[model samples]
Target: MALQNEKNNRYLLRDWKPENPTFWENKGKHIARRNLWISVSCLLLAFCVWMLFSAVTVNLNKIGFNFTTDQLFL
Candidate 1:
């Protein structure tokens, strides 16, 4: 089981020595850019959801849903 798990995790970066220039040039740069773009995309998605909720809450009463102000904010 342990050997199987190790084989499964062979591609995982357990040591992560980005300070080594050769490793950085060969692999670290690609990994860093991938992680950065993933983070940026997730952040953008969260912002869009927040804006949609805010707009809906502000206009809920105008659309005939009688939620209290505190409930809307919540």
Candidate 2:
């Protein structure tokens, strides 16, 4: 039935209509903001991991690892 379909699709966003102020105010805005926060958090985590690796690489030579300049740049 139509009512059952509506219930099932409630969380799917298949019927998204952000142009409709009512829909945006009620649902679309929340979903968009949540996705934005999740994306930002993922990017921040990736940058932190990259910084950790860079710090470790810079210390390798000082720790007597003897990596060549080219090898360390890799």
For every candidate structure, what is the RMSD over all alpha carbons to the true structure, in angstroms? 2.1, 4.8
How well is each residue in 1-74 modelled by candidate 2, as lDDT tens digits? 98888877856657678899999999889999988999999999999999999999989999889999899997
Q: Indicate which candidate wins on lDDT.
A: 2
lDDT by residue (tens digit), candidate 1, 1-74: 98788878846666677999999999888888888999999999999999999998899999899999899886
Q: After superposition, how far is residue 21 of candidate 1 from its true place, in Å?
A: 1.2
Instruction: Name the lDDT value of residue 11 in candidate 2.
Output: 66
lDDT of 1: 0.88
For model 2, the superposed segments whose C-alpha errors exceed 4 Å read 1-11
TM-score of 2: 0.76
- Give the lDDT of residue 18 in candidate 2: 82
Model 1 spans with C-alpha error above 4 angstroms: 1-6, 9-11
Question: Residue 1 of model 2: what lDDT?
Answer: 100
